[model samples]
Target: MITVDFSLFPVGPGDRVLDLGCGGGRHAFEVYRRGADIVAFDQNENDLAEVADMFAAMRAAGEAPAESEAAAETVTGDALDTPFGDDSFDRVIASEIFEHIPHDTAAMAELHRVLRPGGIAAVTVPSWLPERLCWALSEDYHTNEGGHVRIYTRAELEAKLKAAGFLIGPHHHAHALHAPYWWIKCAVGTSNEDHPLASAYHRMLVWDMMKAPKTTRTTERLLNPLIGKSVVVYLRKPHRGSAESTG
Candidate 1:
C-alpha cells in the first residue's frame, strides 16, 4: 500500500523522481502513472527485476498517459552512495526506509545531494508510539536481519533532516487502522499467520485497501493523527544561493 500522499508531495508532468529503497515499487509505479521520469532504486536485484517487468507491462498496457513523456527505469545501488549525479532529481521518495538503515545520516546526505534546489523529498517511517509498542511486544520484530534498527521520535527525525540541509515542511500521519493489526501480529508471533485474530485483521485490511469503503476511510482519517502507524515528513532542498544554502 502507498504511504506517501501525492497531494502534499506534488510531482508535475515530466518531473524527475527517485524512489529510494523502493520495496516492490509501489510508489515508483504511481510516479510513472503520473507521467514523471522515475527511477526505482533499490539494493535488492530481485525486487528491481520485478519492478522493471511491471514498468514494461504498464507501458504495454497503455497505463501511462497517451501524451505523457514519463518513463521508468530500475537502478540497483546503495542508498548512501547512489549512482546519480549531484542535483539530479526533482522529487525523491524515501518511505519506510530510514528505520531499516543503520547509517541513516549517510543515507539522508545522499538524498540531499541528488535532489535539485527547490526539489521535494517525501520521507516516511514508523511512528514512535506504535513502533515502540511493536518492539515491546516482540523482540523478533526489530532484531531480525534487515529489520528496523532504530525508532525515531518526530523531533529526532526532523533534526536529522534539517542537519542534512533540508527545509522541513508540513507533516502528517497515515495508516491508522493498520497499527492494531501489527500489534496483534507481534503479540502472537511475527510469523504466526495462522493466528485467528491476525488473519481476520489482515483480511479486513485487504478489503479496506481494495474496496475502500466510506466507513473505513472516514475512520482512518480521524484516527490517523493519533495512532497512525507511519509518519510522513515532507522536506525541500533549499534553492541554490539562498540563505539556507550556506549550510
Candidate 2:
C-alpha cells in the first residue's frame, strides 16, 4: 500500500524519481506506471534483482501509457552515498527507511543533495504512538537486526529535514487500519507467524487491499488522523536566490 499521497507530491511523464531503500519496489512500480523514469535503489542484491524482473514484467504487460517515455531501473547503493550525481532527480521518495539508519542526518543530507532545487522528497516513518506501542509490547520489534533503530516524533523528523536544508511542506498520516494488526503481532511475538489472531488480521488486510470496500476505506480515513501507523511528510529543497533558500 502507498503511504505517500500523490496529490501532494505528483509525478508525471519525464520526471525522474528515486525510490530510496526500495525494499520490494512498490512505490517504484507506481512511479513507472505514472510515466516517470524511476530508479529503485536498495542495498539488497536479491531484492534489486526481483525489482528488475518486475520492471520487465510491467513493460511486457503494457502497464505504462502507450506514449509514455518512462524507463525503470534498479540500483544497489548506500543511501548515505548514492551513486547518482548531485541534483539528479525531480522527486525522491524515502519511505519507512529513516528509522533503520543510524546516520539519518547524513542520509537526509544526501537526499537534499541529489534532488534538484525546488524538487520534492516524500519521506515516511512509523508514527510515534503506534511505534511506541510496538516497542512496549515486544523487544524483538525494534531490537532485531536491520529493524527500526529509533522512533520518530513528527516534530523531530521535520526538524532534521530542515537542518538538512529542506523546507518542510504538507504532511499527513496514512494506513490507520494496519496499526492494530502490527500491535497484535508485537503482542504475540513478532516472529510468530502462525498465531491465529495475527493470521486472521493478515488475511483481512490482504482482502481489504484487494477489494477496498467502502466501509473500511471510510473507517481508515476517519482514523488516519489519530492513529495511522505511518506519517508521511513532503519537503522541498529551496531554489537558489529564494528567501527560503537564503535564510
Strongest candidate by lDDT:
1
Clashing pairs in 2: none
lDDT of each: 0.94, 0.93
lDDT, model 1 = 0.94
Give the lDDT of residue 246 in candidate 1. 21
Model 1 spans with C-alpha error above 4 angstroms: 66-68, 244-247
> lDDT tens digits, residues 130-225, model 1?
999999999999999999999999889999999999998889999999999999999999999999999999999999999999999999999999
Shift of residue 132 alpha carbon in model 2, Å: 0.2
Best by TM-score: 2
